[model samples]
Target chain A: MTDTILSHDDLTARVSRIFQRAGLSPLQSDAVARTIAAGERDACKSHGIYRIDGCLRTIKAGMVTLDAVPELAPEDGAIVRVAAHGGFSNAAFELGAPELARRAKELGMAALVINDCTHFAALWPEIEALTAHDLAAMAMCPSYSSVAPTGGNEALMGTNPFAFGWPRENTDPYVFDFATSVAARGEIELHRRAGTPLPEGWAVDADGNPTSDPEAALNGAMLPFGGHKGSAIATMIELLAGVMIGDLNSREALDRLGNFTLLPAHGELILAFDPARFSAGREGNAMARAETLFDAITGQGARLPSQRRFAARKRAMAHGITLSAEEIAHLDRLEERGLDAVA
Target chain B: MTDTILSHDDLTARVSRIFQRAGLSPLQSDAVARTIAAGERDACKSHGIYRIDGCLRTIKAGMVTLDAVPELAPEDGAIVRVAAHGGFSNAAFELGAPELARRAKELGMAALVINDCTHFAALWPEIEALTAHDLAAMAMCPSYSSVAPTGGNEALMGTNPFAFGWPRENTDPYVFDFATSVAARGEIELHRRAGTPLPEGWAVDADGNPTSDPEAALNGAMLPFGGHKGSAIATMIELLAGVMIGDLNSREALDRLGNFTLLPAHGELILAFDPARFSAGREGNAMARAETLFDAITGQGARLPSQRRFAARKRAMAHGITLSAEEIAHLDRLEERGLDAVA
Candidate 1:
C-alpha cells in the first residue's frame, strides 16, 4: 500500500502536460503545474500529485474552467475579494498571493477572501509565498463535511484547516498548518489502505461509538482535536471561513461526494502583515526567542510542528524523489494517455 | 464557601472607593472599577471583584503605580505599545481600548500590546468595548505558568485566555471567551473550596497521572484541551502574547512569583478590526450569518459556546444579583479594613 514518489521535474512536466491537454492556457498550466510541484517539494503528498487525478476529473466534468481567470471586485486599501467563478483553487491562489503580498507591503496588512474556487490543495504554498516576501501570513479553508461537533455523534463540521507563517531572519519561515480534527481524513484513508487500526479517540463508528477499526471510523465521524475546546476553535474557524464569506457550512454540503461537479461552496480567507511595520529587528529576535523557549520546553525531546515534513522535503530534494514500481506504472499510464490527447 | 454577588452599581461604587483609598486618581479608579464590575456582570467570578484584594496587595507592595499613564511608542498605523510600568491590566485596557478602537475606525484595524501590567480580570469588557464601537475585537493574555503542555508533566504554559467579540445588527454583540486549558484553574479552585470531585480527564496529579481530586489537581497540572491540537493553539497564543510582545513565557516567569518588588512581565495583545472595510454591511451580516448557522445546528439539540454565561448574565441583570451570607461578611470585612486604612 506504499505510495511511490516521482522525480520533481518529471512530476512537474506531467502536471503541466495534463493541464495543457485539458485546454489550459500555457501560463495557467504553468502556474497550476508549479503549485502542484511545490506541494510535492514540501512533502504534502496528500495534496501533491495525488490530487492530479481529481483535478483532471474536475476539468472533464466542466466544473472548473481551464481558461477562466479570477474576477476581482472593487475594493480599497488592504482588502481584496476574488470571485473565482469555478476556477481551480490553486490557480486562484497563484494569481492572488503575489498581489495580496504586494498590497500588504504597501498597506501594512491586507486581507483577501476567495469565493467559488474548486478544490484547493496544500495551503502552505500561499503562506510560503507571503513569508518569502517577508510578511507574516495566515490562511484558512472550510473543508467538506467529515468531522463531528465535540459531543455530537453526527458529522457536522469540516476538517477546517488553518495555516500560519512567520518570517525568520536567517532560517526558513516558521510555518504551522493543521486541521481542527484530531487527525485528518487522509490519514484515515492511509490507515484503511494499509489495513491498520485507527487510534483511540480519533473517530467514532456510525452508531456514535468510538472504534479502532479504520473502516468503521471512515464510515463514521472524525473527532475534533481537543474535545470541546477544539470544537469551539473549529466553530470559530467555520464562522470565519464559511459564514463570514457567505458560503455553505459542512452540513449543507454533505451530499457532495467525490464528484467535483458537486463541490461544496466554501470560502478561504488570507491575511498578510509585515513584521517590520510592527517591530524593527523584532521579527528575527522573536523567532530566535521562540526557538529558545521551544527548545527549553522540548529540551532535545520536543518536536516542533511540521518538522518532519520539512525534513522529508530536504532529503527528497537532495536525492531525487523515489517512486515505487506500482506508482511508476500508474504514472506511465497517465503519461501515455496524456501524450495521446496531445497528439 | 458560596460567593455573593452585589448590585452592579453597589459593587462598582465600592470598588471605585477602594481604588481611590489606595491612591488611584478618581478617573482611573472609576474606569478600573467599571471594568471589574463588567466581569461580575458577565459572571466571570474569578476575574471579577474577587481580584480586588490582589490588586490592593500589589499596590501596597509598590509594584503597581496608582497614577501611571501609558505613552505610545513611535510606530506606524494604529499600533500602540504601552509601557505599563507596573500598572493594573484593567487600567491599561481601559485606557488602550478606546484609543485602539478610535484608530481602527480610521485604519480598518489596530492593535495594542501591554508590556508590564498586573493581573487583569476578565477580558470581556475590553472586547465588548470594541464591539460597542461597531468593530470586531480580539484580546489575549499570557499569564505566569499554570498549565502543563500536552504530554508533559511540567506546568509550562499559562491558561492563556482569549476573548473575541462581533457586533450584530439586532442582538447583543456575540462574545466568545475561554481559557485554552481543558478546564480553568478557577474551576478547580471552586471545586476544591466546595469539597467536590473533578470530572475525569480534566487534570493530572503531580506525577502526571490523571486525578479526580480537586486538591490533587490543583497541586498538579491542568490538561490542555484537545491534546496536541489544543497544545498547538496554546503555543501559538503564547508566541503572539509573549514573544511577539517582548515578554517572558510562563515557565520563564515562575522564578519571580513571590518577588514583590518585580512585576510579572506577562503580556497582552488586543486587536480590533472594522469588517465594513472588507464588505458593505459585513459587520451585521457576519454576526447574523453566524447566528443563523449556529442556531440551525444547535436547534436540533446542540449547545452553543458561552450560552450558559449569556443566560446567567441575563438572569442576573433581570432578577438582581444576590450575595450569599458568607460573601456579604467577606465584603463587609474588606470595606471595614479599607475604612481603617483611610483613617
Candidate 2:
C-alpha cells in the first residue's frame, strides 16, 4: 500500500504542469503548486496533494478562477483588505505574507484580511514567512462549517484553525497550529470513509447524541476540544475571521453553492508584529533571552511544540518525500485528464 | 459548624486593619481591602477571603514587603516594566492599569510587565477597568508550579491564568478568564480537605497515573484541559507571561526556596489595545459594528463567556454582597487576632 518516493523538485514540476494545463496563469499555477509541495514536504498530507482533487472539482464547477489575482483595497493604519476576485488562497497568501510583514516591520504590527480567496492549503508557510522576518505572527481561517457549539445539535461553526509563530534565537521558530475542534474534520472524514469507529467525545450523531459510528459523526457535528473554554476560543476566532473580515459564516457560505463570494474572502487573517520594533535595538538580546527560557523548560526532557514536524521536514528534504500509492494514482489521473483537456 | 455572615463593610474594614497592622501604608491597605472585597462581590470566593489566611502566612514568613510599591521603568514603543519590590499584586495593579491604558491609547497598543508582585485576587476587575476605557485587554499571570507538562510526572508548570476583555457598543463588555489547568489548584485543595474524589481526567497522581483521589491529585499534578492542545496553549502563555516579561518560571522560582525565583519574580503581563485606533476614525460606527456582531453571536442562543458572572455581580451588588456564615466567622477571628501579630 505504500507508494514510491518523489523528489521534491520532481513533484513540484509535475504539480506546476497540472495547474498550468488546468488554465491557471503561470505565476498563479506555480504559487499553487509550490504551496501544495511545501505541505507535502512538511508532512501535512491532508492539506497537500490530497486537496488537489477538490481544487480541480471546484475549478470545474466554476467556483474558482484559475487565473484570478487579488488587488488591494484602501485601509487605515496597519490593516489592509484584499479583494481576491475569486483567486486561489495559495496565490493570495504568496502575495499577502511578504506585504503584511513588510508593513508590520515599518508600523510595528500589520493585519491583512483576505476576502473571497478559495481554499488555501497549509497555513504554516504563511506564518513561516512572517517569522523569517523576525516578526511574531498569528493567522486564522474560517472554513466550511462542520462543528457545532457545545451542547448544540446543528453545525453552526467552522473547525476554524488558528496558527501562531514566534522567532527564537539559534533555534527553529516556535510555531503552533491547531483546529479548535476536538478532532479535525479530516480525521473524522477519513475514519468515516474507512468505516471505522471514532473515539468517544470527538463527535456526536446528528441528533446530538454521542456516537462512535463514524458515519453518524460525519453526518452530525464535531465538538469543541475542551467544552466551554475551547468553544469560547472558537467563538472569538469566528468573530475575528468571519465577522470582522465581513465574510459569510459557514452555513451561509454553503448556501451559496459552497462558493465564497462575500466581500473580504473567507480564508485567513494574518497578523505580524516585528519584535525589533518592540525590543528597542536589543533584538539580539531579547531573542537570546527567549531561547534561554525555552532551553530551560525543555532541558528537563519535554519536547518543544512543532519540533517534531520541523525535524520531519528536514529529514524528508534530505531524503525524499513519500506518497501513498493511492495519492500517486490520483495525481497520475489528474495529470492525464489535465493534459487531455489542454490537447 | 458554619460561621455567621459578615457584612461587606465589616469584612473590608477588618481586612484593611489587618493589612495596616502588617506595616502596609494606609493607602496600600485600602487598595488591598478593596480588591479582596471586589472578588467576594463577584463570587470569586476562592480568590477572596479564602486567600486571606495564605496572605497572612506568607507575610509572617517574611517573603513579602508590606510597605513596598511598584517602581515604573518605561521601555520603547508603549512597553513598561514595573519592579514590584515584592508588594501586593492588588496594590500594583491598582497603580498600573490606568498607566497601561493611557499609553496603549497613545501607541495603539501597550504592554505592562510587573515582576516580584504578590498574588492578586481576581483578574476580572482589571479587565473591566480597561474595557471601560474602550480598550480590548488581555492579562497573563504565571504563578508557582502546580501543574505538570503533558505526559510528565513532575510538576513543572504553573496553572498560569489568562483573561481577555472586549468592548461592545451598548451592552456590557465581554470578558473571559480561565486557568490553564483542568481545574484551579484551590479547587483540588478544597476537594482534598473535604476527602472528596475529583472528576475523572482532571488530574494525575504523583507517579503520573490518572487518579480520582483529590489528595493524590494534589500531591501529583493537575492535567491541562483538553490534553495536548490545552497544554500547548498553557506552554505558550508561560512563554509570553514568563519569558517575554523576563519573569520566573514556576519550577525555577520554586527551586529558590520553595520560592522558585526563576525570573526576576513571578510576573503578570497586561496588554491593552484601543479598537478606535484601528477603526479608521469612525468611532460610533466601529462600536456599532462590534455590538452588531456580539448580538448576532449571542442571539444564536449560546451563552457568552463570563456573562453569568457579570450577571451575578449585578445581582449581588443590588442585594448587597453576601457572605457565607463561615466567612463571617473568619472575619471575626481576624478582628480578634489584631493585625500586627497575625502578620
Candidate 3:
C-alpha cells in the first residue's frame, strides 16, 4: 500500500490527541506533540512517532506525572528556571524559553534550567527555539548511564547529548546535536538484532576487554566518542546539568528507573546568548560574520551538521510527512487505545 | 652539565625579567610570566619556557603590542569585557577574572570576553582562575586557522582549545583542556622532523585526500577530533568567541598575521557558573556532589583529566622545577639579549 502523507500540523494534532487521550495534561501533550512531530518533519525517525510508544510505556509504568503543569520559577539573575514538576522536559522548556530569551537579551546571556523531568527528546528542538529568537544557544543533559568513561571498565556516564546553534539571517540556523557516546545503545541493539559485529572502539565487553561482538557489548558498556575528550564532555554535562541542577545524574537516574526501558528523569541546562548584545559596538555584524564561516565550510564541499534534517524539513513542509502503512496503523491504534496501545 | 632547579617564584621572576628586558610592561610581563611558570610547574613543557622564544619571535615580528595595558570595560549585565589593546591575553584574563568571578557569583552565571589579544597560553590557566573562586568554568578561544572542518579538505577552523573546570572542596578542581583538532600542528611538525608517518585520520593532504605522510599532513589540514562533532564545536568557538565577541576569527586572524609564526590576535570567551547559586533550594551540595562523580571515575580506574598535571605540580612545588642545562642556557640568552635573542 502507498504511504499516508500528512501535513506537519496534521501530524502534530494527531500526536497531541494520542497523548491527551493517554491522560497527559493538555500543556504536556501539546508541547510534546510539537517536538515529536518536528522529529518526523526533519526525518529523524528515531525520535519521531517512534518515541510515542516509549512515552506511553513510561506513563503506563507510572513513571511520569500525567497531570503535571510545568511552572516557571521567579526571575532569577541570569537564570530562568522551570520546575517540570515530574513531567516531560518539552513543556518545561516551552514554559521557560521566552523568559530565557528575554533575559539573555537583557543580561547578554542567560541560562534556562529545567528540573525534575523525564527527558527523551533530542536537544536540537530546544536549541532551535532559542535560535529562532536570533540568539546563539547551547543545551545539554544526561541520559541514563550506558556509556563508560574512557579508561574505565564499566558504564558510569550517560550517553549525554550536547547541542549548539547559531542564528542565521535568512537561512536555517547552524545547529548540531549529538550523543557523546561513540555509538548509541540503540545502534548496538540494532547490531545485535541483525547479528552483526559491532565496530571496534564502539564498546568493551562485560569484563572491559575491547570487543566487536554485539552480545558482549550489550552485556558491557558503550564507549564515548573521541575517547577521553568526549568522556570529559559527558562528565561535564552530568556535573552542569545533573549535579549542579540538583537533579539525578546518569547513575542515579538509571537506579531510580531500574532499567533503560523508561525515559530517564533528569535535568537540563540551556544557555542563550543575544548576539546583538554580545556583538555590541564590535566591528562586523555577528550574523553576517557567521554566514562567512558557513560559506567557507560549504565552499570546501563540507556539509554542515543538521543540513539533511533541515532539507528534510523543507521538503516535508512543502510536500508532507509520509508515514508507511504500518506506521499509520500504529498511530491509529495509539489514537484508539491510548495507554493500552503501548503494552 | 647538571640541570638547574628553581622555585616557582624564582622561575616566574626570571621569566618576568626576560619579558621586561624585551620591553613588555610590568603588568603584561608579570601575568604572562606566571602563566609560563605554572605551565612548567605542571610539567606541561609545551607551554613552558619553550614558549618564550615564540613570544620573542612574535614580538620581533611586531605582531604584539609592547606596552598595551588591558582595560576593563564598564560592567554590562552578565558580560565582563577586557580590551587587551593587542597585548598577550594572559594579562587581559588576569585583569578580568576577579570581576568575572564576582559577576558569576552575583548572577549565577557570567561571561568574560577578552578582545584584541594575542592568545597563545593554554586555556586551563584561565579555567583554573575561575575554579579557584569555587565556580565551574568553561573557556574557549580561536587560534589561527590550521584545522579543517570534518568533511572539508582545507583548513577553515583553528585548533581551537576548549577547556572546562569544576570546583572541588579539598583538592584541585576537575579540569580538562584540549584542542578540538585530532592533533596539534606541532605534533605533525615533530613527526616530520623525526621522519615518522602521521597517524591515520590526523590530517588530509592538500588535495583533501587522507594521508599518513607527516610532511603532506603538515602542508595540508589537520582533522578535528571526533570528526563532525569536534568540527561543529570548533566552528561554534569561531562564532561565539570570535564573531559574537566582535573579534578576529581563525581565518581573519591568520590573514591579519600573514603567517602562523606569530600568536593569533582574537578574543576568548570564559563562562563562570556559581554552583552554590545554581543548586540553591535544591537537595545536595554541588561541590560535594561533584566529588562523588570524581570518585566514581577514579574507582573505575579512569583517571580524571588533570591528575598527571597536578601530580607534577606537587613534585615541582616540593623540589622546585628542574630545567635541563640546554633550557637554562636558552633562558640566559633570552634574558641577556631580549628580543635580539631570536632570529
Candidate 4:
C-alpha cells in the first residue's frame, strides 16, 4: 500500500465518524477516537486509527456490546473496580480514572481494575490519565494468545503490554510503553507485508522451528523478547491482569474471540501512586532527580525511554501524521458507509 | 578454593553467630540469618550468606548503624512506612510485614516503604513475606550501578531487581525474581570463574563494545536483558525506589559502598494486594486460574518460574545446603572470630 499524509484532525474525525456509524454512543466514540488520535500523534501507527476496522469487525460480529455503559463498582479502601460492561477499555478508563486518581492522591496509592473489557488499543492512555494529577502510574493488560512461552511451541500468553508514566518537573510526563515480545505483532505484520526477513529468534514457524521468513512467522507464534525472562514477565501479567482480576485467561479469551477474528475480552490492572505522599519531605524533587538520570544517560549518547515517541508527537503536532494509502482508503470506506463496503 | 556441603541447620547457626559477632540485635540478626539461610537453601548463593562479610565490612565502616531500631511511621490509610534507621531491609521488612499484611487484609491493599535501609540480599524474601498471607505481592529495589543504559558505556543503572509473588492453589506461590539485565552481575562473575564465554549482547567492554569474554564483562558493564525494554524497566526502578523514596541512588550507593565491596545503600518498594477484595465473587479462584496457566505452559515443556528454586529449597530442607569449601571456610572464619579475620 502506498503511504499518504493526513492532518491529525482529519484522521481523528474520520475515526470518530466510523465509530459513530458503528452504533457507538457519541461519548464512547469520542473517547475511543481521542485515544487512537493520541496514539497516531505519538507515532504508534499500529494502535492508532489502523485498528478501527478491527473494532468494527468485532462489533459487526456481535462480540462487543456497543450500547453497554461502563459502571464503577462500589469502591473499597484505595481500590476501584470498573465493570467495562463488555465494552472497549477506553471508555472504562474514562469512567474510572478520575476516581482512581482522587483516591490515590487522598490515600497515597490506589488501584483500578477493569473487567470484561475488550482492550484492543495500547495501554498508555489509562496510565497517562493520572499525569493530570501529577501522579506516577503504571498499567498492564493481557490479550489473547500470540506469544509462546520459552521452550514451548504453542502460544499460551499474550504480548502482555505494560505501560508506565512519571510526573516530571515541568515537562511532559515520562512514559514507557512496551509489549513483552521482541516486537509488537503489528511490526511483524509489516515485515510480512514488505517480504522482509526477520531477525533470528523473533518467532518460530508452525512446526516450532525458528524461521526468518515473515510468512512462516505469521503462521506461527511470536517469541518473547529475552527468552525465558520475557516469557516470565508476560506470564506474570496474564496472572495479575487476567486470572487474579477474575477475567478470562489467555486460552479462554482466545477460544471465545477466535472465530470472531477480533480482540479478546481482556483485563487491565492499573495503579497510581502519589509521589508527594511517598517521598520524605522532597515533594517534586523526585522528578528533578529523574531529570538528572535522563541527562546522565542521554549525555552519554544513550536514549531515554519515550524519547522517540515524544519527538514524533512534537513533529506530528507541528506538521501532520502520515498513513498508508490502504489505511486511508479503509478509513474512508468505513466512514462513508458502514461495514457493508468491507464485509 | 573448593566446594563443600554443609548442613542447613549448621549453616544457619553459623550465619547467626556471625551476625551476633557483628553486633546486630538478636532479633535483627536472626531475621538476617534466616533470610540468608533461605537463599542458600534455594541455591541463590550470590544473595545468601556470601553477603555476610560485606555486611560486617559496612557495619565496621560505620556505614550501617547496628543499634538502629526500625520504627513504623504513623499509618496513612493503607500505607505503612518503615523507618529502618539506617539498618538492614530484612529487619525493616520483619518489623513491617505483619502490620502491612493486617492492613492489606483489612483494606484490600497495602504498601510498605522502607527508608534508610541497606538492602543487599535477594528481593524474594520481602515478597515472600506476603505469600503467607495469600497476598499478591511485588518488590523492587535498585542496586549500585553495574548495568549500563543501552548504547552507553557508563554504569548508571542498577541491575534493578524486581520480584513478584502470586498465591497459587495447592502449590507454593508463583514467584519470579529477575534482574532487568540480560544476566545479573553475579552470573557474570560465575562465568568468569568458570572461564566460560558469554552470550552476545550480555555485556559491553570498557570501550562500549559488546563482548563475549566474561572478564571483559566483569570489567565493563552488564547490558539490560532485552535492550531498550529492560533498560526502561531498570530506569523506572531507579526512579521509584531511589528517587521517589528519597534514598541514595545507584551511583550514590556505589560510591559509598565501594571500599566495602558491598552493594550500595539501595531503596526498596514493596506492595501487597488482597485479591479476595478485588475478585468479583471469585474469592480464592484467582489462584486456581493461575494454576491453569502453569499447567498449560508446563505441559508444553516450559518451566514455571521459581520451579528450580523451589526444588532446590525442598532438597536443601531434606538433605542439606551445599556450600563451597571457600564459602564454608569463610563462614567458619567469621563465626569463630569476627570482622578481624576478614576485614
Candidate 5:
C-alpha cells in the first residue's frame, strides 16, 4: 500500500472506536481519542498513535477505570474541581475547563483541580482548551518516579511536565509543554533499543554516578533539565499538583502501580487567568501588548515554542494526516482485536 | 582589619539611615532596609549591602521617586493592585501582601499586582512573606532586556526572576528563586571587572555567535537556562507580569531607562494559594503531606533549595552578621556623605 491519509475528524473517530471496542466508555474514549488525534495532526509522534498501545496496556491491566464518568464538584470559589474517579484525565479536564474559564473571568484567576486520574496526555491540550477562551493558562502534573532530584542518587521525582499558553487574536495560541527531565525516559529506552550511548548528563547509574550507557540509565535514574533549577521546578509540581491537591505524588503513584508499564494515577492543577480582567484598568490592551512581545521574539529569528507543531497542524488540516502501511495495519489490528492487540 | 559584626536590627537601622540621608522617604527606606538586612542575614551577599550603592546610583540618577507612598487600588475580585508611584517595589509589596493572603484564603487563590515600580530585590523575600501566612506563593518580574531568547541572537528578553515558596509547619518554608538566564548579568559584569573569561554557553557576542570573552559577552546577549524552555518561561513572565498588568516589559523598561545603570521600572505579579482551602475535602493534611515529600528529598541526600540560606540565617541570628572592615568603611562614608559618597 502507498499510504493512508485521513482527516482530523476521521482519525479521531477511528481512535475512539478502537478505545470503545477495548471497553472504554464513549465519554472517556472520545475525549482521549481527541487528544491522540491532535498528537498525530500536530506531528508529535511520541504522543500520537504510538501512545495507544501503552494506554491499552493500562486498560487491560485494570490500572484505569474504562467506564468512569468524570464528575465536576459544586462551585468552590475560584476553584473548579473535577473528580476523575480513576479514569483518564482527558474527560475530567473537558468536564472542568468551561467552569475554569468562567471562574477565571469572574475572579480574574481560577484553578482547576483534577483528582484521582490516570494522567498521560500532554498538558498543552488542556492549556489550549483554556487559551481558546482568550485566557492565559498553566498546567502541571507528576508521572512515574523515574527522574532523580538534583544532587540525589535515586529516582524520587517524576519527569513532571509543565505547560503554559497565551491567547492570540488571529493566530495559533502561544503554547509550550516540556518535561523537567533533561531527556524523556522514552528517549533512553529508544537509545537502549538502538544500542546507542545515552547523552552525557541525561542519566545516572544505580549508584547515582553519571553514565552514558542506556542500559545502566534504565536501571538507574534520569536527570532533570538545567540541573538544580529544573529539579526545583519538578519538585514544585509534586508539591502543587500532587501533594497540595491531596492526591498521589510521583513516588506514591509509582509505589501503587509497582511498575512503569502501567499509567500513573495522580492529580493535576490548571490555573487560568483572564487577560481582560487582569488588565481592566491598565494602560495598554493585554492582547495587543502580547502581540508586540511575540513580534520581538520572531523578529529576532528566535522561533517560538510549538511553531513546528502548529505548522504540522496546518498541513494536516489542509492535506490530511499521513500514515505508513504499518501504522495503518496496526490501527486495523487495534480496531479488530481491542485490548488483545496491545499485549 | 578585623571583621565588624552587628545585630540584624542594627544593620537594618544603619541601611535605613543611609537611604534616608540619600533622600529616600522613611517609608521607602525602612522597607528597603529590611530586605537588604534579610539578604545579609541569609548570607546572600550578592543581594546584601552590596546592593546599596546600586540603589543610591539609581537615586542619584533621579530615576526613583524619593517620597511617593504606594497606593492600593480597591479590591477587584482576586486581584490586589498596588501602584508604586515610581518608587521601590518593596513598599508596594508590603502594602499588598496581607491583602493578597486574605483574598487567597477567601477565594482559594488571588494575585498581587505591583505597577510602576523600580524592582531590584530578590523575590524570595516576597515569597517568604506569603509563605509566612501559610500560603503557597509564586512571584515573577521583568528586568532590563539583557538576555536573548533561545534560538535568537539578540537580547529580546530580561533575565526575568521566577520565585516560588511553600509553607511548612515547623520550619522555614520551601523556597527557590532564580533567573531564567544561564548566569546573572551581574556575574558577567564581575567577570569583566576581574578580566576573567566568561563561561561557555553563558552568552553570545554582538554577532550572536557564542563567545567566552567577558567583554564580548557583556556587549552581546546572555543565554537563558535550559535553552528554549527557559526562554518560553521568561516570555511568559513578560506577558503575565508585564503586559497583562498594563506595565512595561523588558524591552520597554530598558528603552525607558535608556541605560542599564539604573533599575528598570516595571510591574510584578505575585500569586498566592491557600493550600488549606485547596485541599479542604481531600484526605490528607496538605502541610503534613508536603513534609513527607521533603523527607524523601533529604533522605536521598538531595538538598532542598534554600537550605544553605536558612543555615546562614540561623548563624546570623545567633552571632550577628559579619562584615569586612572595608564594607563597614564604605557604609560609614555612605552615611556621612549620602549620595555624594558614590560616583
Candidate 6:
C-alpha cells in the first residue's frame, strides 16, 4: 500500500467525523479529535491516528460512556481527586486543569487524582497547558500491562507514561513525556512489522530470557529502561497513579475492559505547582535561572528534551503529517463503520 | 589498609566525640553522629564512617555553624521554607519534621523547603520519618556537579538524589532513594579507590566520549543513568531543589564552598501527603492496595526497594558495623585536631 499525507485540519476533521458518527457528541468528538491531531502534529504516531481503531473498537464494545461527565470526587486541601466515571481521560483533564492550577496557585502545590477513565492520547497536552500559567506540572497514567519488574518475569506493569513540564519566561516550555518501559509497545510492534530485530535489553522472550526478536519480545514482555532504576520508577508510577488513586491497575484495568484491546483502562495523577510561590532569587532564582540549565544543554550541543518533538510539531503542521497505507485503510474502515453506527 | 569493626553505639560515640571536641554543641554532635551511624548500619559505605573525615574537614574549614539552629522562613499555607542558617541539613530536617507532618495532616499535603544547609547524610532518614504518621513522603537534594546532560559534554548537573517512601498497614514503609546519575559520585570514588574499571555508559572522558576507566571518568564527568531519561530527571531535581528553593544550583554549590571541598551545600525539598486524604480508596483502594504491589516484588524473590538496607541495618546493629583502617585513622586524627579547635 502507499502512504498518505494529511493537512492538519483534514486530519482532525476526519477524526472528529468518525467519532461523531460513532455516537459521541460533537463536543466530545472534537475534543478527542484535537488530542489525536495534536499527537500527529507532534509526530507521536503511536498516539495519533494509530490509536483510532482501538478507540473505535472501545466505543463499539461499550467500554466508554460517551456522555459521561467528570465529577469532583470528594477531595480537598492540596490534593483533588476527580472521578472520570469511565469517561475519556482527555475530557476529564480538560475539565480539571483549571481547578488544579487554581488550587496549586493558592497553596504552592496541588495534585489531581483521576480514576475510572480510559486514557489513550499522549499526556503532554494535559500538563503542557499548566505551563501557560507559569506553573510546573507533572502527570502519570498507567495503562495496559506490557512490561515486567526488573528481576521478575511476567508482564506486570504498564507502559506507565510520565510527563513533566517547567514553565519558562520566553521560549516554549521545558516539557518531557516518556514511558518508563525500554520502548513503547507500539514501537516494538513497528520493529516486528518491519522484520527488524530489537536492540539489546529492550525486551525478553516468553521464558524471561532477554531477546532482540521483536515478536518474541512482544509475545513476552518489554524491559524497564535503565534496568532496576527504571523498573522502580514504573512501580512508583503504578503506586502513585493506580494504587494511590484507587483506580484500576494495569492488570485490573485490562481485565475490566475485556475484549477492548484498543482501550487503555487507566488511573492517572496530575500535580501542579506555582513557580512564583518559590521565593528564591525572586529576580533570577529557580524560575528565571531555568535558562541557565537550558544553556548548559544547548551549550553542550545537546538537544533539549522534547526539542525534537517541538521541531516535529512545527514541520508536521507546515509540511503535513503522513500515514502509512495500512493506517489510512484502518481509518477508512472506521469511517465506514461509524456511518453504520450513525444509521 | 585492613578493615576494622565497631559496634553501632561505638561508631556513633566515636563520631560524636570528634564533632563535640571540634566546638560543635553536644546536641549537634549527637545528631550528626546518629546520621552517620544510620548509614553505617545500612552498609552504605559512602554515607557512613568513611564520610567522617570530610565532615571534620568541612567543620574545620569554618563552613558549618556548629551552634546554628533551624528557623522557619516566612512562608504561608501548605508550604513552609526553613533556613538551615548554614548548618547541617540533618538538624534542619529534625527541626522541621514535626511541622511538616502536622501541616500535611491538616492540609492533606505540605512541602518543606530547606536552603543554606550542608547535606551529606543519607536522605532516607528525612522521608522515612514521614511514614510514621502514615504520610507518603518524597525528598530531593541536589549536590555538586559531576554528571552531564545526555548531549552535553560538561558536567552541568548534580548527581541529584531523589527519595520516596509510602506507608503501609503492617510492613516497613516501602522506601527507595537514588541518585539520578548512572552511578553516585561516591560509587565512582569507590571504584577509584579500588582501582577498578568503571562500567560502560557510566562515565565520559574529558572530550565527552564514553569511557570505563574510573579515574579518567572521575577526572571528567559521570553519565546520567538510562541515558537521556535520567538526565532529564536530574534537570528536574536541579530546578526543584536548587533553583526553586533559591539555593545554590549544583555548580554554584560546588563553586561557593571554595576551598571547602568536603561540604555538599545542599538545598533540599521535602514533601509530605496524608494518604488518608486519598479519597479514591477508603478501604482497599490505591492508598491501601500498595501492599499488592509489594507482594508482586517479594513474591518473585526480587528484593523490595529498601529491603537490603533494612536487613543490613539490622545485622549491623546486632553484629556491629565495619570501618576501614584508613577510616579509623582519619577519625582518630580528627579527634586529636578537634581539641585544637576547641582550645
Q: Which candidate achieves the best DockQ against the true structure?
A: 3
Q: List model 3 lDDT by residue over A1-343, tens digit each.
A: 7799999999999999999999999989999999999999999998999999999999999989988999999988998999999999999999999999999999999999999999999999999999999999999999988888999888889999999999997789999999999999999999999999998899998788899999999889999999899999999999999999899999999999999789999999999999899889989888888899999999999998999999999999999999999999999999999998877
Q: Write candidate 3's Cα lDDT for B30-104 as tens digits.
A: 999999999999999999988998898888899889999999999999999999999999999999999999999
Q: Model 1 clash pairs?
A: A226-B226, B4-B323
Model 1: per-residue Cα lDDT over A186-206, one tens digit each: 788889999999888899887
TM-score of chain B of 3: 0.99
Which docking class does model 3 fall in? high
- Encode model 1's per-residue lDDT on B44-134: one tens digit a residue: 6776767677666656666667787765555555566666656666667766777777767776667787776776567777777788888
Docking quality tier of model 2: acceptable
Candidate 3 chain B minimal-lDDT segment of 10 residues: B257-266
Model 2 C-alpha lDDT per residue in residues A1-343, reported as the tens digit of each score: 7778888888888888887777777877788888888888888777688667666666666677777877776544466666676888777777777777776776566677777777656677788888888888778877666777776656667777778778876667988888889988778878988888899888877887888888888788898898877876776666555654566445555666543322123556787766665444322355666676566547645566778778878977898899889878878778878734321
User: Compared to the true structure, candidate 4 yields what TM-score?
Assistant: 0.94
Tell me the native contact fraction for each prediction.
0.20, 0.12, 0.87, 0.70, 0.79, 0.63
lDDT of 2 by residue, B1-343 (tens): 6534446676677788877766676766787788787777677776677667667666666777878877776644456566777877777777778888887777556677677777645677788889898887778777667777777666767777778788776677888888878998778878889888899878988888899999888788888887877777777666666655556656555665364222223668787766666444221354565565455456555567777667766876677676667667766676567444354
Clashing pairs in 4: B182-B225
The residue-by-residue lDDT of candidate 5 on B92-174, one tens digit each, is 99999999999999989999999999899999999999999999999999998999998888887899999999999889999
Residues A238-271, candidate 5: write the lDDT tens digits: 9999988889899999999999888899999999
Question: What are the candidates' C-alpha RMSDs?
Answer: 4.2, 4.2, 0.8, 2.5, 1.0, 3.0
CAPRI-style class, candidate 6: medium
Q: TM-score, chain A, per candidate?
A: 0.86, 0.90, 0.99, 0.92, 0.99, 0.90
Q: Once model 3 is optimally superposed onto the true structure by TM-score, how far is the C-alpha of residue A194 displaced, in angstroms?
A: 0.5
- Predicted candidate 6 versus true structure: per-residue lDDT over A1-343, tens digit per residue: 8899899899999999989778877766777898999888888777787677777778777878788778875547887777777778877777778888888989889888877777887778887889987899888878877888888777878888888999988678899888999898878889989999998999988788899999899888898988888888888787777776667777677667663266877768888887778664333666557888788788887778777778988898788988899878878877887835321
**What shift in Å separates residue A78 of candidate 5 from its native position after superposition?**
1.1
Q: Clash pairs of candidate 3?
A: none
Please, what's the RMSD in Å of model 6? 3.0
